[model samples]
Target: MGFTSAWSISAHEDAFITELVPCLGPLIEAEETEPGARERWERWQTSGVDDDLVHLVTGGGHVQRLYRGLTDDDPFCVMDDVWGQEGVEERLFFSAFSKDWAVRGLFQAVGPARAALLPGWCGNFVLTSAEVRDTLPRIEEALSCGPLEKADADRRSGLDYLPDEESVLDGPLRMWRLAAQARIGLCGVSLVLD
Candidate 1:
């Protein structure tokens, strides 16, 4: 099976994990029975998570790559090893539970980048409102440049599944737009890429 990425935007991380995740099924059920619940229920259903703490930001594929490129200094250099080696993957998975492992793995994979950029490559991390604010313009520029096709071509020589360029940018653009919203509203956003 191929890798797919999903994003969750949330203001309250603790409540999201402890309270929201566990109650999603009932919430969806309750919403379904309401008069205008379909639209609301549909939003929660799309998050791919069952909870009120986080809203799923939906769009394209290769979001991990797009985010990395947008936030890193040597974006193209990291593209050479987009998925990373086995060791890096193991570390990335480990990072889910250990922040130390995440920091180490991020440095190893991308090499000497800002702490702010680590969340883009790793799972289960939060970006501050300032970080989100700073990143908005870069995300915009990356989307406008439309380099996914070339990046894909440069990263791999022969690939059977090539993603649509438009579709590729949609996810990250939407995610970042949501991040901007969260920042404007004075809330921190947590990014969960799975």
Candidate 2:
């Protein structure tokens, strides 16, 4: 099984509840109106509602844990499941772009040429709004240049690297656009790996 990566939009708990939740409530309600959605909606509402809220806004997978308590001084233990850790809770999980695609396709296509970008080495990290804003232009430029070439390994494995066909860049591009929007709104962009 491969790891999936997504851009998560997060903010302090007060901001999330007051600012972002209202914006998403209508959308979540509308989605629930669709057939076969009631079960998922009820499940989300009853158990792990915060995670449900995150899934609702960013359109990503379940986020069992969100915040790190103030007393947790260790930066490496940011995801501890302590009771007070859920305070800074305005987080939203977004797209699930594969790690393989990020390293082999997107980074290779847009980063400096010949750079050995390794997906496995990229653990979860946060991207500030400013960082997201700065990177958007480069990614957009790369996308505008046209479809990217597949990794050499994919090519060697007899996979067709068609420029006109769908490539690995599609998912990340969509996620980046969303991240850019969140960045413009002054939200923190975190890259979560699963």
Candidate 3:
């Protein structure tokens, strides 16, 4: 599995499905849904609605990394090990919850508004833009303190999975890249389950 990201143009997921995903289209030559689709596509292309999302797309696959040596252990918990911050493992989401619910939960669960959500990180959590912004500094601080590999290695022998090579794909670095891109994209990283 991997991850993809975008700028948070909306509290819901409209920009992701409509704006950012379409930016991947080849120069905006809209496709035909049926026999008469091309004409409709062309009309929309020249409709003078400015494509506002082109500039927000970040280059590179930030969350695109193989799960080489990861365990079921929470990465945010690993962050806690480095940052000494508590309750992070609960704050993250990886599932397809309703946008309003997820966004509200994240906002409430991460900051001064956060409460006893009572064991979060259930069913594939996702973070919205505000949540990402709230948690990013802690990530940055944790990265500065130490590598996640160190903390993770203690739990399981993830190092054994490594080949005798130097240029291995680092999970922590990939996380940083994802967070950075999400910050710029005004969105949070969405894990792409394989």
Candidate 4:
């Protein structure tokens, strides 16, 4: 009933879009030609996302590749409420931990402006292969600033917290790995909020 994150590695954005747009054609035509079709589908929709669409998308390349061969042991996994931004949570009225602060810290280490690019948990976005390669150095610099180090400092500063903090802190690292993999394959990283 909560959020489930899904991502993919694509040769390019248009490749996935080419796969997606056609899938939506029938839905659009149905809405126009069939009376009550829009209402019927809307009944199953939440926040403008059709239930059927999510089911279809989660099965395709744009969603499947990232999920392939993954297991419960993977820390930064799909299908969890571990993400989202403050604006989205407020507009949708879902009170959830977005990991915004945690992720933002990583980007903030790069520059405050880059932090703004952090997308909503359920937001669809892409990072091209070129982007992945280009951003590595800055991302590495950000990593050095200590999402983990900050956790340790917080503890030392008398702010007691859970010992499982490292797992949560690993989001950026996992993200880095994902991006790197995308780069290696000459693909782009696609986050599909389903």
Candidate 5:
């Protein structure tokens, strides 16, 4: 069964510990200089992130606010992925590349093919995590029975039209707005499903 309608995610104190610790692993790593650096670093290097944790970096305060809301309990001391209003995507991409490249470099440093599975913690899962794999059957069941999932899939498919090659590459902020809205919207959907 698949997820059909959005369910409520209780904003509880332990939600971050159970749900978001994996999602914020990268962010926690990027801000290693902050206080409580040691624990945050260790968690980032060890936690396994699932695919349900969609990476959404935004410039507006909304994204940061969302992160803050989720992490308020433990105050995950990480750099807010929101970097002003211009370089959000660039920063996120760079951070991702840095982690992936650093892992490969570590492999090169120690020995060939030794650094299996990126050494540190898992970032975001793709679409094949075991939890998600199991969850999807339930989700499918829900989707088959309800209208929520079908409606969202249809909506997102429509959004696919907005971020094509010509439109996004045509200008800067033009695509930025579209991309931001799409990302935020999708994130909301994911949270609802979760």
Candidate 6:
């Protein structure tokens, strides 16, 4: 596994997300060409009626921190925390999901000092080397489970629909995450620690 340098990125103000739609239009159209693609996307738009998903990702590991703040002030700037917004941190095996938007994230331990500063840090796990090995199969199982097999079930299931290509993989710095894909319009950060 390889480790990449840590960095931060932010969503736009107002929407709390950078509108990558225009840039992502081509990719969305491509997904439309995949098997049952359009139906899957529509289903995703409606899935997750009541559950706030606590997805997990475990691979080597990467430390990525994101925050929601005044886009006007930071304007695409990245920060260390949720920036007064709600978020969570935990140790996890690398994982990704396909519900509202294909999401791939990581889990890492927060230092005593930084944990005090970051929000969304309850009930998260700290990963161990052995735990990492144990978690890989689980992560693979989660990703290989298949696309949203039922209508509206995806929404109710608390995850966006994902195609096989969206599987998370080991990246630089032992980091495992979903490669940037079209269906993943909603973006969030997963922070992991060594």
RMSD in order of candidates:
19.6, 17.1, 19.4, 14.4, 18.5, 18.0
Which residue segments of model 4 deviate by more than 4 Å?
1-14, 17-125, 145-148, 152-169, 182-194
User: What value does the lDDT take at residue 139 in candidate 5?
Assistant: 30
lDDT of 4 by residue, 106-126 (tens): 322333333333331212234
In order, the Cα lDDT scores of the candidates are: 0.33, 0.37, 0.27, 0.34, 0.26, 0.27
Error of 1 at 6 (Å): 5.5
For candidate 3, what is the TM-score? 0.25
- Name the runs in model 2 displaced over 4 angstroms: 1-102, 105-124, 142-144, 147-167, 184-194
| Model 5 lDDT per residue over 99-151, tens place | 12222222222222221222122112211123333433333332232356434
- Global fold similarity of model 1 (TM-score): 0.28
Q: After superposition, how far is residue 52 of candidate 2 from its true place, in Å?
A: 39
> For residue 10, what is the lDDT in candidate 1?
34
The full ranking of all candidates by TM-score, starting with the best, is 2, 4, 1, 3, 6, 5
TM-score of each prediction: 0.28, 0.32, 0.25, 0.32, 0.20, 0.23
What digit string (tens of lDDT, one per residue) describes model 1 on residues 65-101? 3334433463531222322324323212111211122
Instruction: Indicate which candidate wins on lDDT.
Output: 2
- Model 4, TM vs. native: 0.32
| lDDT, candidate 3, at 61 | 26
Model 5: per-residue Cα lDDT at residue 137: 39
Residue lDDT tens for model 6, 51-75: 2222212211211211233245543
Decide which is better by TM-score, 1 or 5: 1
Where's the lowest-lDDT run of ten residues in candidate 3?
Answer: 115-124
Worst 10-residue lDDT window, candidate 5: 185-194
Which has the better lDDT: candidate 1, or candidate 5?
Answer: 1
lDDT per residue (tens digit) for residues 91-194 in model 3: 22232222122222222222211211211111012334445456556544433323565444223312222243211122322343454554522222322222
Please state the error at residue 28 of candidate 6 in Å: 32
Q: Which of 1 and 3 is ahead in lDDT? A: 1
Q: How accurate is candidate 2 locally (lDDT)?
A: 0.37
| Candidate 1: C-alpha RMSD after superposition | 19.6
